[model samples]
Target: MVKYFSNDVDIRTTWDLVVSAFWQRYPNPFSGHVLTEDVVFREVTADQRLLSRRLLTKTNRMPRWAEFLFPANLSRSVYIVEDSIVNLVTKSLTTYTWNLNHTTLMSVKERCVFQESEGRPSLTRLRREAWISSGVYGFSRPIQEFGLARFKSNQVKAMKGLEFALSNLQGLRLTVAERRHGVSPASKTQ
Candidate 1:
């Protein structure tokens, strides 16, 4: 069985800042399961859009009830491939990500778009979609249900991580601005 999920959220920030935070989202407190990220390919297209592919390694922690179903050889880590495009002209970013292993057990794919909110210029909107499926014989339904639940939980963390990164980026920029003006940190009013 396959399950689909979709959600939309407005981030109280500009699109440019959201995009910047996206690239620096790792190492945040909420995303400790994300082990490593490597850029496999990156280029600026003729139309000035940034295109990139990345490989990410993430810990795959199975629910205790489902652990017995998986084979012993199955690794505890999952490999995911992410492809993204940043279109400067449109002021938007889009990304697609999917796992490359253990498809027969379960598969999850996600796509997200980040753009400025139509009604609120200061806010950025994120539209996210996900598909979850399982090929396990009699356990497909249960496995798919589990996948969907886990996906939702992880997405919440993902957003928090992005917000954490954005907060840090803003702080760093402010510090730089203060330094450029020869203002001492201690002199600034909190």
Candidate 2:
């Protein structure tokens, strides 16, 4: 079965600030599960779009009752690959991420779009679309269901993390014309 989730965040900042925060959202208070993130690749297209690829490692606990249902190798850690593109002309950012490991057990795909709100030009909008699925034994159906529930629970925390990161970044930009790529305050080791 395929389970889905959706949410949106509105921040009183330009889309640029929102986009900048996306690159530095990890290491925030609410995302302690994230262990590390590395930029695998980054480049600017001829049309001036920013494209980036990243790898992230995270850890999460399995419900105590379901511990025995998974293999011993099913530790808490999960690795994922993320790809993002920012279009200057459209003033929008699009991201796609999926699990690199644990595909046999399940697959999680997430898509996010950030843009300047049409109604509120001074506000940026973040939209998320994610789904989970598994093909393994009949066990995957239940596993996916459990994951969806956990995802829903964690969704709010994730948005708060983003807001915190964005706030830190927004404070750094003295002006909209000045490009600020400074590292997020929470981007460093806690």
Error of 2 at 12 (Å): 2.9
**How close to the true structure is residue 66 of candidate 2, measured as C-alpha lDDT?**
70
lDDT of each: 0.94, 0.83
TM-scores for all candidates: the values are 0.96, 0.85
TM-score of 2: 0.85
Q: Listing every candidate in turn, what is its Cα RMSD in Å to the true structure after a full C-alpha superposition?
A: 1.3, 6.1
Candidate 1, 1-190: lDDT as tens digits = 5899999999999999999999999989999999999999999989999999999999999999887887767798999999999998888899999999988888999999998888787999999999999888999999999999999999999999999999999999999999999987999875
lDDT of 2 at 62: 78
> Mind giving the per-residue lDDT tens digits that candidate 2 earns over 105-144?
7788999898889977789888888899887786887889
Q: How many backbone clashes does candidate 1 have?
A: 0
